[model samples]
Target: MEKVELLEAVQKEEENIIRWRRHFHRYPEVGFEVENTANYIAEHLEEWGLEVAKNVGRTGVVGFLKGGEGKTIALRADMDALPITETKETDYQSENIGKMHACAHDGHMAILLGVAKVMAFHRKFLKGSIKFIFQPAEEGPSPGGAAPMIDESVLEGVDYIFGAHLHSLYPVGTAGINLTNMMASTDNFSIEMIGKGGHAGLPHESIDAIALVFRMYQEIQLMVSRNNDPLEPLVISVGTVNGGVATNVIADKAVLTGTVRTQSKNIREKIIQQLEDKANFISESEGGRCNVQIERGLPPLVNHESSSLMVKNAATKVLGKEKVFILEKPNMGAEDFAYYLEEVPGAFYWIGAGNKEKGMDYVMHHPQFDFDEKALINGTKIFIQTLMDVWN
Candidate 1:
């Protein structure tokens, strides 16, 4: 199909796509607890006469559409929501309390479903198999959802893969593509400071954990500034701190949790080691004990140049060349889609979701975050057109 025809076809299904997106949005599930979302994906794919597989990587659904001889391609969409209260007072606001589609995974699933419907209808024109992956837990669960899905052989025989993120940072109808390092690596760390407790009035009798924590936080900033290279992009954020039970008593223990983001693996490693060493040294010197736990998260998303070129070409053919935006710098946010790219050579691009006039400018993961619904149709069309461009 021609680009216009493809977009028109997707536009024709706009209402149905909206219905799917809203339904999933209302019943938002977090992490690996996406049973209803998985069921809905499976039913839709099966209804379209595609072979559906469930229970892969726990609550993940995979649908396959086979065609004549060629390379196999896989398209992925995350189905997990965030653990946040819905603040967007829309008719389709999340019905589940303390859970919401704050990250726009509902739209992601709908776009992939829209593409699956198009691929099913045009299966005869396809020269290769297309796998639609509805993955769970992209947000985080220790090792994340991508590695488990891959370990379950979700990418078997898959030669290439494609995925897209709805970015609130960009305007609707515009797409962003990067040829290398589109996102950073994320790792988390926690520190527990153990000290002696006594009356707050008796300072010399007890080790002051609150004072120690404040010093530790400041020292961490200094460590990054002095130890890391001036040219490297690195960030250390201490987000949570908890201690003390009562105002009259000096806290016996303090807990601190934070995250580190870096552009390269070498810097990531250096930051982690420095964090541990600094925390340990400070706590011991203060006559207190410290335990640090560092958990590794997703690696940086490196976009393959060839795959990105293919995506740009396909997108230009579908949308106008002027619609595509070449990003100058990678965002510090991390994605588990990097795991899929580790096994298969592919690129992950962003679809713009910002529209100031429509009041859709909230950043992702915010309680009031929302996107322009028109991006759904545009994303679906681009995916279908890219498949045709790649397969033909």
Candidate 2:
């Protein structure tokens, strides 16, 4: 089938697409609690006559649509929501308090489902197999859902995998298909400082742990500027700090938790080592003690050439050559989809959902974050095009 005809088939399912997205959005679930989401997806996959597997990675669901059984291609959609509360006033706003699909995983699921509908209808034309992966916990409660899914053999015998994210960084009609790197590697660290406490009036009698933590925070940036290569992308941010109780009393204990992001694993390791070393040095100098813990997160997402080329061509064919964009640089944001790329040759694309006039320009993970619903058609078509164009 031609690209336009396939997109037409997807467009016919627009109502159901929006229905699925809103249903998931209203009843948002977080992390491994995607039981409802998985069951919902599994029911649809089974209805389409696809072989369904539930709880592959706890709550993850994979649907296999075997055509001629030549090669298998995986299409992944994350099924988790963030911890933020919904601020939008729409009727479809989250019914679950303190949980929302702020990152647009709802849209991701809808797009994949739309693709599944189209693919199942056209299964006669498809020469290979298609696996629809509805993953849990893409928004990490650390280590993420992709690694566990892979551990359960999700990527076994998959020749090529394709994934897409709906981002509010560009206008709704455009899309980003990077030639190489898309997102950076992300890892987290926490530091706890222990010291002697005393009254504010006392100077030498008290060891200020908060002061040591502040100094360590300042020194971490030097690891990026002075130690790593200037061209190498790296970011260190302290997201949380807790310690002192009162202004009159010096803090005896303090804690700092943050994240480290880099494009290179070597740089990631070097920066982590410097963080621990600096924390120890600063604490000891202040007559205190420090403990640093580093937890590894997702690896950097780099698109393989063949799969990337397939997406680039399909996106260009669907949207036109002018609307197709190659990202100027990779983002510091991380994705668990990187784990799938580690196992198979795959590419993850970005479908633009930003429209300033529609008040849909909020970025992902923001409390007011949302996208133009029209973008769903484009995302759905892109997935369809990529799959059909894979063999061509």
Candidate 3:
């Protein structure tokens, strides 16, 4: 089918897509706990007569559609929500307390379901097969969801993969395409300081674990600034610190939890080692014991050159050339889709969902984040056009 015709078809089904998205948004779940979401997706796919696989990688749902069959292409969508509570006063505001679809995974799922509908109807005309991936926990409770899905063999036999995220940074009706790195690698670390506790009034009697914790935090900042290359971008953020039962007592133990982000694997590894070493040295000098735990999370998301070119060409064929913008720099945000890219050649891109006039300009994961409904049609058209282009 032609691009305009495919877009028109998606437009006709806009009401159903919105209905599905709101239903998902009303009952959001976090991380690997997406039981209802997975069931809903599997139910719909089964109704569409596609081969459905449930629980591929802990609540992940996969669907398969076969046609003339040259090579298989995978279309992926994340199926997890954030832990933020909804503050937006809409008819479909989240019904579950302390959980919300603030990151637009609801929109991503809707777009993929729309693609399934269109592709299912026109399966006879397809030159190859299509795999629909409903991935759980892109936002990650720890290492991330993509690695688990990859371990489950989700990318096997897949020639190319495609995925997209809703972005509030760009204006509505616009899309971003990148040929190189699109996002950074994320790693987490925790430092624990152990020392003797005593009365605050007697400074000499206490080992002062709090003091050591502060010193370690400060030294980490210096390491990022002075030790690393000035041209490279690196960030070390200490998000949480807990210690001390009372203000009058010196804490016996202190815990520090934080995140580190880097663009390259080598930089990430070096920063991690330096962080551990600095923490241990500072604690030892202060007469305290130190323990550091470093956990590697998702790798940087790098879009292949040829795959990105295919995405751009498909987008241009669907929407005009004026609507597609090539990104200049990689974002520091992390995506679990990087795991899939590690196994196969693929492209992940951004679909604009910001419109100030409609009060939809809030960033992803914000309490009041929302997307323009027009983005649903735009995303659906792009996926359909891209699949047809790739197979042809």
Q: What's the lDDT for residue 354 in model 3?
A: 90
| Candidates in order: C-alpha RMSD to true structure | 2.6, 2.3, 2.3
Kindly report which residue pairs in candidate 3 clash with one another.
none
User: Candidate 3's residue-wise lDDT over 240-335, tens digit each?
Assistant: 998889989999899889999987888999999998899889888878889999988878888998999888888777677998889978899998
TM-scores for the candidates: 0.90, 0.92, 0.92
**What does candidate 2 score on TM?**
0.92
Q: Tell me the spans in candidate 2 whose CA falls farther than 4 Å from its real position.
A: 1-5, 195-208, 242-252, 284-288
Candidate 1 lDDT, tens digit per residue, 35-137? 9889989999999999999989988999999987887899999999999998879999999999999998999999999988877886666789999999999
Model 2 agreement with the true structure over 185-272: per-residue lDDT tens digits = 9988999999989899995899998887888777877776787788989998899989999999999999999999988777888888
